[model samples]
Target: MSISTVAKKLPTTAIAATVIVLGIGAVAPVAQATVLTFDDIAPISYFNEIPNGYGGFNWNNFNYINGSSPKVRRTGEDNGRVSGDYVAFNGFGNPALVSDSVFDFNSAYLSATWNNGLSVTVEGLKNGATLYSKTVIVDTTQPTLVNFDYFGVDELKFTSFGGVEPNYLGGTGTQFALDNFTFNEKATSIPEPTLLPALFAVGTLSIGSVLRRKQLNQS
Candidate 1:
C-alpha cells in the first residue's frame, strides 16, 4: 500500500483499539460484597452523633430526661444502663433516650454515605403504641466494597396518649436501653456476557477499514 494509505489506516486502527479497551474496562466484573454486623458498631469511630433525648443531650451521652416527650432515656445513670424497650445501642458505647412519647423523628440521619447495592437494617423497639423504623438507599460509587456505609431515617413519630404502652417500651417513665444493631452490603451484579458480541463487532470493523484502505490504494 502507498505511504499515505498506510498512514491514514494507522490512526483509525489505533482509535478502534482504544475504544475496545475502554469499553471492556467499563464493563469489568464487580467486587465482592462487604458485611458489617452489630460488632462493627462497637468501634464507635464510624458513627456520628444524632439527637436522641430532651435537653439536647443526643444519643452518645450517658443519661438525661424528657418530661413532655417520649424520651430515649439511658437505662442507668452515668451510662450504666444497656437494655430497654426503647433503646437503640448497637453494642457500641452509651445509648440515648428518644424523648417525647408522641414526638416525630424527622431530623435523625446517618452520618456516612453508602453505595448503590448496600442494605442497612435497624432493629429497635416500638413502644408506647408508637413504632419506629427507617430504611434508606445511600448514594455512593460502584463496587460497594467500602466500609462504613451510613444512611438515615425520618418522621419516626410516636403516639401514647391512650396510655396503651406498647411492649417495646418498658412503660411510661421506664427507661429503655439500646441492645444491638447490624449493617450489611448487598452484592453488586456483574456485567452481562452478551456484551462480548458488540466488542467483537467493533474490532472487526476496525480491521475491515484498514484492509479496505489498502485495497483502494492498490487499485
Candidate 2:
C-alpha cells in the first residue's frame, strides 16, 4: 500500500515517467526535427510580404499566433517543390507550421502539394496524446516526398487530409505546399534534471558505505 498507494491506483491518462537515478535509469533522448524547407526563406526575407521564420519554424494561424489575421508569415505563395521553395497552408483553419523545438517524433520526410484533394495528417503530440500518425495525398503537379510513422513525442503536427490517397508525392493546390519536412529529435543528452538530487545522493551514500564496510568485515 506504500509508494503512495501505488501512485493512487495509477492511470492518470498515460503517465509513464521514470527516474531512479541511483541505479541509473532515465528517459527522453532522441533527436532529428529541424528539416523544414521553405527553401531557406531568402526569396526576399520579408516583414513586408510575410513568410519569415525559417529553420526554427513558426506560423500560428489567424495570422501567426494571436494577432487576428492582419498577416504575419505563413510562408505562402512562391510555389515550387522540395528543393525550390514550398510552404503554404490555408486549407482553412487546420494550419500548422510549428517546430521551434520540442520533438521526439520518429519518422518523417515530406513535400506536400495539395489543394481540392485536401490530404495530410502527420501528427505526434504529447501532453495532448496522439503519439504519431500519417496520412497522405497530393493532387500532383509538383512537391512530393511524404512519409510517416511516429512514436513517443514532444509535439509535431500537420493537418488536412481528405482520406489518404497520394502515398508520397503528387499535387493539386487548395494551398498546402510544404516541403522537405523531416523529424527525429528525442536525443536528450542526459545528466540534468537538476543533477538528479545530487546524483541520487551520491548513489545513496555509496551504497551505505559499502554496506557498513561489509558488516564491519563480518565482525
Candidate 3:
C-alpha cells in the first residue's frame, strides 16, 4: 500500500487494536480456591493463639483448640472439629479478624463453644469498606456449614452475639468455632476498562507510525 494510504489507515488500525485490548481487559481471570482447615496449627495445652501469617492471612483474636485436651468435655472444644483435632475459636469472646490480599470467601463450618444457637456475624471488607455481611446461628453439639461466597474481599471480620448459656461448660461466652475456611484468591489492581483502550491506542499508533516511516525510507 502507498505511504499516504497507510497513514490514512493508521488510526483505524489503532482503534481496532484498542478494541482487542478492551475486550481482554473486560475478561476477568479465573480464581483458584484455597481451603484453610486450621488443623495445621498445633495446640499448646488446651489451645494456642493463631499466629500472624497462618494460611496466608493476619489473624487477630483467634486461637486453635486442641480437642484431645482434658478440658474438651467441659469446654466443648472438640464438638466442632471437622478435619482434625484442632478448630479455631474467638479468644476472650471478642471479635475476630483474618486479613490478606483480595479474595473470595467461599464457605466454612461454624459451631458454638459454650452456648447453643449462637449468633455470629461475618463481614467481608476491602480497603476498610464493607462488601458483604451475614449473621448465622450455630449449635454447640453440631456445626453449621455456612457458604458465604463473598468476592473480592481483603478482610473477614467475625462478631458473636447472644446465645443460651450452658451451665455445664466450665467457661461460658459468645465464642464460636471455625473450621475448613474456604476462599478464592483474586488478582489485585487490574487495569480499568476505560484506561485499557487509551493505553492500547497509544501503543498501536506508535508501532504503526514506525512501520510507515520505515516503508517511506525504503522507497
lDDT of each: 0.31, 0.47, 0.82
lDDT leaderboard ranking: 3, 2, 1
| Alpha-carbon shift of residue 34 in model 2 (angstroms) | 4.1
* Tens-digit per-residue lDDT, 1-219, candidate 2: 354444344433212333343323455464546565444444433222225454444555412121112232222233224454334444453656454456544333333333434576766667777766777765434445555645446556677645333433342344455545566555557664543454344445556867899999999
Report how far off residue 205 is in candidate 3 (Å): 18
**Which portions of model 1 miss their true places by more than 4 Å?**
1-22, 27-86, 89-176, 179-195
Better of 1 and 3 by TM-score: 3
Q: After superposition, how far is residue 3 of candidate 3 from its true place, in Å?
A: 27
Tens-place lDDT per residue, model 3, 1-219, is: 554454455566665676585663465667678888877775476788998998889999998888767787644467887887888999978999999998889999999988887899999999999999999998788778999989889999999988887777766788898988998878654655664446545656678889999999999
Ranking the candidates on TM-score from highest down gives: 3, 2, 1
lDDT of 1 by residue, 1-219 (tens): 553454354555554564565553455453343221222222232223344532221334322222112243222211222222222322222223333222222222221111122233332243433244434332121111222222222212211111123334343322222222222222354554343454455546777977999999999
Q: What does candidate 1 score on TM?
A: 0.26
Worst 10 residues of 1 by lDDT: 154-163
- Candidate 3 Cα lDDT to native: 0.82
User: Any runs in candidate 3 off by more than 4 Å, and if so which?
Assistant: 1-29, 74-76, 188-219
